[model samples]
Target: MAKGYIEFDYEFCKGCELCIQACPVNTLVLTTKMNKKGYRLVEDAEGKCTGCASCALVCPDAVITVYRQKKAS
Candidate 1:
């Protein structure tokens, strides 16, 4: 089975951990590496999300976008 979710734009991210904490299902994690602006980027933790948009709503940078997979028949 494959997992689905949003992908973050690391370059635009400000290392703000709001997305990581905002996730309802504990799906997101922050990376140690910094972006062009020396900010940490958020990464998905492989199949933990419930496709909720909490993080996207709270993100000031608007770098986060959630993509949900269709249910199998």
Candidate 2:
């Protein structure tokens, strides 16, 4: 199995929840934190991101970056 995580460009996020909905692992959630633009933030609740890039692909603001651990040969 692959392991991965996501980083959010917090300031650019509009709290649209698109990334949350696009996440296949259901690890994404809304947080109490707010961006400079006053939009609520999303977080990887369980650290279970699969680096699928689904979230990033769906983000209208392009705020998400997914990073995966390289598999050992």
Candidate 3:
């Protein structure tokens, strides 16, 4: 089956958690893992993303890039 994913620019992320709230699939979450600046970052909690880009849309820093995998027929 086709699946979706997101690539996050952790360095640019401000840990605002907006993306986590915007995600429709509830796949995104904030982790205890810190970035280079010691700020917690959002991560893909579930691998079931649908590439809706809702998380990307709400990100103030534009740190998310989404990709979709095509399923074989």
Candidate 4:
């Protein structure tokens, strides 16, 4: 299972690739498909996301929400 996952608000997102660049785990990428606004959507690539919030921090549109699983102690 992935350590974390991100949810994107495609309608609010501007399709900026800043989130993709900000992801330390390289979990995000810009897809060819467009959102309702006709902007290319950012999607999660196949990878392990560490839930660092880097993508959320860099997003100007505040479109990304991250969910992380708690590690077993």
Candidate 5:
């Protein structure tokens, strides 16, 4: 089960593939399709991110946004 979700701003993403390479957990992947700007944007591997936010920190384009899971009530 997923603990959180990550959003990728394809508009701002330069498609440099830095996020893909920087992911320690191998959570990021480069899709075959390009973004609106015709750039290959980075995508998060579903159910893979540990909420470590490594991709968010290393993103040069600052397009990765990680939302962590909320605490139990």
Candidate 6:
């Protein structure tokens, strides 16, 4: 299986939770940390992301970026 991870653009996230809801692996969680805009940030709770891009697709702010590693042969 391909390994995956996500990066968040903290400034752009609005704490909408849409991405959290869309994540199939349940990797994302709302954090106590806040950005300059004062919106709560979301983070990868577990390192189990599949790079499916579901969270990115649902993010209205386009804050999430998913990266996948190619499977070894």
Could you say which candidate leads in TM-score? 2
Clashing pairs in 4: none
User: How far off is residue 57 in model 4, in Å?
Assistant: 0.8
Q: Model 2, which residues run further than 4 Å from truth?
A: none
How many clashes show up per model? 1, 0, 0, 0, 0, 0
Please provide, for model 3 over 1-73, each residue's C-alpha lDDT reduced to its tens digit, 9 standing for 90 to 100.
Answer: 4578899998998899988888877888789998898889888987879888899889999999999887667
The CA lDDT at 59 in model 3 is 90
lDDT of each: 0.78, 0.92, 0.87, 0.85, 0.77, 0.89
Give the distance in Å from residue 17's predicted Cα in candidate 5 to where it truly belongs. Answer: 1.1
The candidate 2 region of ten consecutive residues with least summed lDDT is: 18-27
Show model 1 residue runs off by greater than 4 Å: 1-3, 71-73
Best-fitting candidate, measured by lDDT? 2
Better of 5 and 6 by lDDT: 6
Better of 2 and 6 by TM-score: 2
Model 2, range 1-73, lDDT digits (tens) per residue?
Answer: 6999899999999999988888888999999999898999999989998899999999999999989999898
Candidate 1, residue 72: Cα displacement in angstroms equals 5.6
Arranged by lDDT, best first: 2, 6, 3, 4, 1, 5
TM-scores vs. true structure, each candidate: 0.80, 0.96, 0.87, 0.88, 0.80, 0.92
Candidate 1 global CA lDDT score: 0.78
Q: Which ten residues in a row have the lowest lDDT in candidate 1?
A: 1-10
Which runs of model 6 end up more than 4 angstroms from their true locations? Answer: none
Candidate 5 residue-wise lDDT, 1-73, digit = tens: 4366688877898888877787777867778878778988677756687676777898877888889887778
**Model 5, CA-based lDDT:** 0.77
Off by over 4 Å in 5: none
In candidate 3, which residue pairs clash?
none
